[model samples]
Target: MDDTGLLVIVDAANVVGSVPDGWWRDRRGAAERLRDRLAAEGVPGHPGPVEIVLVTEGAARGVESVPGVLLDPAQGSGDDRMVDLVAEAGVFFFFFFFSDRELRRRVTSLGADVTGPRAVRPAGGAWAPRRDG
Candidate 1:
């Protein structure tokens, strides 16, 4: 896909925390799952090509990037890193997925359009098992 489309920055912690699906037990796994989902589904609303960056921190820092999803491990705070990304990519149209009020305000001030975790989370609040049989 072209890199010229919208930039989607996903806050790993925030999005994972949005669903209490025992993610606290395996933060890295949770982040990895999010990365894989982004790789498979892309963003729900934006059907165009998008450069998805999953910002990870704390225990989820080492989650690696896949084909479509890029992992950015924050040195300090994921929110700060996301804000920096928004500021750096000021040219591209941005769609940020996270629910922190302060983070939302910070990114919005930097010209980023913000959405909550629901933007990336599963429709039923929990992931359903894929049935390909």
Candidate 2:
């Protein structure tokens, strides 16, 4: 979308919720941790550069955007906001990180490539670049 690389929109709530590492105790901290992870690791299967938009809502709001990641705080429903982003982007190629089936379907219907939260962070709660030969 920005001519840099794929536009990766991350569902913070879904991604964070994907793991049960006591994140529910600190929602904002969890989102920030995810943001920092993105800033450091980036979208793992995607080799090229990318523009990452981390969408946050509820207690996760007010999270600041880092260098490689931009924060999008949703006023109401985070799912709705993500849908609006895909619709507004038109036919641009996108890589979306989401675990929500309905949200995945909605974005995919708009021609987005949807993947699970593990795409950003594995189920083990760690993110290491895939080394494929």
Candidate 3:
């Protein structure tokens, strides 16, 4: 087990893109919105206390960190960064990753638990809820 508590690293683009929304027009905005929600509600299924890291890249780059969520803005490939994070944490550590197929194998090989966007976003919702005016 990790000397530190659980780590939850979210793939900002993956989660944002997983749900169709006006995010295409404002990628950073969507990422920020997601960050806020994660900071507030957190991703479900965590067995105990945990820390959250939101990895931002490509269109969602430059999103800043909030109180509970640490923003990891990838310099290039977000997948590479996510891999690096898990690698840094020894195998005993428990991590929950929010991503899809491409990096699952690699992440699993490193011994980190992986999950999909559905764990965070609501099921059957085509679009992320827009902020109220």
Candidate 4:
């Protein structure tokens, strides 16, 4: 299958919250680190071709711009924005990292294929799909 039609939506806060490394103490730093890791992974084209969007609440205070990585700062709820993105991003293969049952249900209701928890590396790093069961 052509991977070009794939779209990835990252729940920045969720990802940060998943790890117990005091990420909440420094949200901006955590986000920046996540963005850097994601950029290195080459999102849309990693493992296959896919467009990626990183959704976060508030401003992206410390994150830098990276090609193929769209930073979306939600004014209200990131989940709402994610739903909107899924609605508008066409019939591409959608993947999200939210672990919330309701949010996951919402994403799936929108017909997105979701994944989770694994460490997503840059282009040259290993790519292993996170198993959620």
Best by TM-score: 1
Clashing residue pair totals per candidate (backbone < 3 A)? 0, 0, 0, 3
For each candidate in turn, the TM-score is: 0.91, 0.88, 0.85, 0.78
**In model 3, where do residues sit more than 4 Å from their true spots?**
1-4, 123-133
What is the descending lDDT order?
1, 2, 3, 4
Q: Which residue pairs show backbone clashes in model 4?
A: 40-122, 41-122, 44-50
- Tell me the spans in candidate 2 whose CA falls farther than 4 Å from its real position: 126-133
Q: How close is candidate 2 to the true structure, as a TM-score?
A: 0.88
RMSD per candidate (Å) reads: 3.4, 6.1, 2.5, 7.5
Residue-level lDDT for 3 in candidate 1: 49
Instruction: Quote model 3's TM-score.
Output: 0.85
Model 2 lDDT tens row, 59-86: 9998999999999999999999999998
Per residue, candidate 4 scores C-alpha lDDT tens digits across 16-78 of: 677676666667667777777777755543477766688878555446557767788877898
Tell me how candidate 4 scores on lDDT: 0.71
> How displaced is residue 70 in candidate 4, in Å?
1.2
Candidate 2 lDDT score relative to the true structure: 0.86
- For each candidate, what is the lDDT? 0.86, 0.86, 0.79, 0.71
lDDT of 1: 0.86
